[model samples]
Target: MIWNENIECASRDSMSQLQTERLIRTVKRVYHDVPYYRKKMQEVGLVPEDIRTLDDLVKLPFTTKTDLRDNYPFGTFAVPMSEIVRIHASSGTTGRPTVVGYTRNDIAMWAENVTRSLCMAGVTKNDLVQVAYGYGLFTGGLGLHYGTENLGASVIPISGGNTQKQIQLLQDFGSTVICCTPSYVLHIAEVLEEMKIDASSLKLRVGIFGAEPWSENMRRDIEKKLKIKAIDIYGLSEVMGPGVSCECTHQAGMHINEDHFIPEIINPETLLPVEPGEVGELVFSTITKEGIPLLRYRTRDLTRLIYDKCECGRTLVRMEKCKGRSDDMLIIRGVNVFPSQIESVLLEMSETEPHYLIFVEREGNLDTVKVQVEVQEQFFSDEIKELQNLTKKIKYKLESTLGISVTVQLVEPKTIERSAGKAKRVIDNRKI
Candidate 1:
């Protein structure tokens, strides 16, 4: 993987030209090294020579989550296991876990992407980073860790548990930066408030959060609560891990490391590339990776792509906050919806907490979605009718925002699960 630190600032025409060259190389590599990709390409009448330019990428076959699952273990690995240095995988909640292999160069490439993300977030060697994301097969912890290290910053690898110890380290070590999921950060803020800890007194300055979809409203809440700048980071286990792109200090949008990874927005139904600034499924192709290289891997995440230069002087392409996944999208009574939409609306209501669940079901040939909300006493009035009115208000707000009617069931505080880690927002029962 070539880590040209200046690629982000490279001219647009030059970046596209570089992408074309890398695409040609990646196409040849996948077609020659991986049998699965070769078969798929053959089915689509695609050959290495067929992909001569960036536009020719559409001629290649699109990869999917199912492809990774069908390949299982290392079936899709471009290199032998001996050459691979690291392994990461999806949670496989829907089916068998889709695993990814990384060679030394691949690992270096991933670290470089993460490092670039940190640089975009204004993290430097002088900052003390506290990584609160989970370790293990999950890539959040180590991804951010290696990136921070790559930037020559001091990292405290407090991998996601023991909130008190995490705080103590933040206070005692004077950690200046934090990384974790946005919901987990909010939970930590709550704990800090409970323990009467002064977050303003803490040395924390910025937080990079990802692994799940969030909204700008949520960002404002997190920044206000923690008294730190909250930036968004995005990645998936399929492509690499957390650090494919990140928000700049300007907070415009996440800048994709276009030199290493090629991003395309494609229509979900047709699997064809969409025009810039249009919403569609995100696809990625690893250019500088050596291990388990992917070509046109369809990341179900939905977002728009921007080609304008960022205020930070990086000319790399930018992507908006992921709206939802193509597969994760739900249709009820001709209404299209997403879990993140429900979560966003829930977070806005003063009567509610971040803890909630979306129950999707098929009742009598009709799709049903019930949003379970936790009501707080702060907004919960003494009169039962007033509390009922508050519930209606929440439902009306959600309906207006989501453009779909949802049954909002208000429950007692702490009745639903509370986590110092990632919050599970959906209890989907409609299994395909």
Candidate 2:
């Protein structure tokens, strides 16, 4: 069912007016309060007064992850420390982390967005949601946690990992909904299989999966293995976490909460807006955020937006499932490849399991890619000739799809390591 019918189903004329109003206020505030933003605005030769309409948003300088990293600490926050009630930083693997602070109102807005997302996935106040996303500095766990509470649903804040305990609670609590990265949910499914327990035994009816780009084939696998509707949710730590947009039960596309944050798509290479329905980098401008209101924040995610009204009766614009990230695209030798492309090919084959990883390395001035794929137990046999043929078959499929030859190593089921978070899809060892 639809949540916040007034806003979600609002007409384009009305939504644009609301966005323009918030954008004007946010731009004015950031220009006046945040020095970094003020300087960026100066560099663009535009002032807050120039941003009178949503069309003027193009005048604002784009914010990048580098900008956040360079600032570190509390450099980009618009509000004073006295007003900042909570702080969340990115779990960066290198360099200083991108820090984000939130006011009480910001937290409430976040909760409202997440609650709306849960409702989009058909979650009711009576549903028990088991949030398996990790907690702490990561936004996934607490983001979902606060939203579930706001929705008045019973939430089991059982964080990630602990396979045994996760299954134990699922059986005992009979939670109707689960939330976590798509890959982690697959890992849980594997554990359930090892324990000789069937998914039908649980009460889980829906799963909200995000944090990593997954294939449509993989969604089918999740649905079959978990016996639940695998709904795709979209968000990032920089944008506002997993509740930014979510797929309704119709499963057409994720509906963006345009009232709180406005969405835009731009050509990554040219840094210009792409035509409607054309894939490009996704950008967000947080108009309602007070603690750290970002103007024209580039998210680097590559996806197209849909404007047609959905069968679910929501007029909120929809974003197609992410094709891949412009930043995440791996350029091996001359051809660019995405992990999801390989995943789609593997999942479509019955003999191969869903678990796999890609290793990119440089040797003697040449780039090499090796794919480690898990073969189903029935397909993993000692017959060298049969295994060789199977490997060749998979290699041909991948080569045809990716337009690049890759070394395919077929291993027994459960050989590839399973992760409790976003699956480590690629390991690039090139010293570029």
Which of the numbered candidates is closest to the native, going by highest TM-score?
2
Residue-level lDDT tens digits of model 1 in 1-432: 123446878998999999999889988998998899899999978789999988888787777777887878888889988998899875442324568888888788888889888888888889999999888777889899988888899999999868899889988999999998776787789889999998999999999988877678879988998899999998877788988898899898899988878999999998877877999999999887887778888888899998998878888899999887787555443233666666666676654446777887755323567888877767778899998898798889877766557788988888888777767666766432
Q: What TM-score goes with each of the models?
A: 0.77, 0.78
Compute the lDDT of residue 327 as modeled in candidate 1: 78
Q: What shift in Å separates residue 418 of candidate 2 from its native position after superposition? A: 31
Query: What is the Cα-based TM-score of model 1?
Result: 0.77
Where in model 1 is the C-alpha error above 4 Å?
1-5, 329-432
Superposing all C-alpha atoms, what RMSD in Å does each candidate have to the true structure?
11.9, 12.1
Please tell me which predicted candidate would have the highest lDDT against the true structure.
Answer: 2
Clashes of 2: 0
lDDT of 2 by residue, 259-372 (tens): 988999999998899998999999999999998888789887889999999999999999999876677667553334768778878777874447888998766334679998
lDDT scores in order? 0.81, 0.85
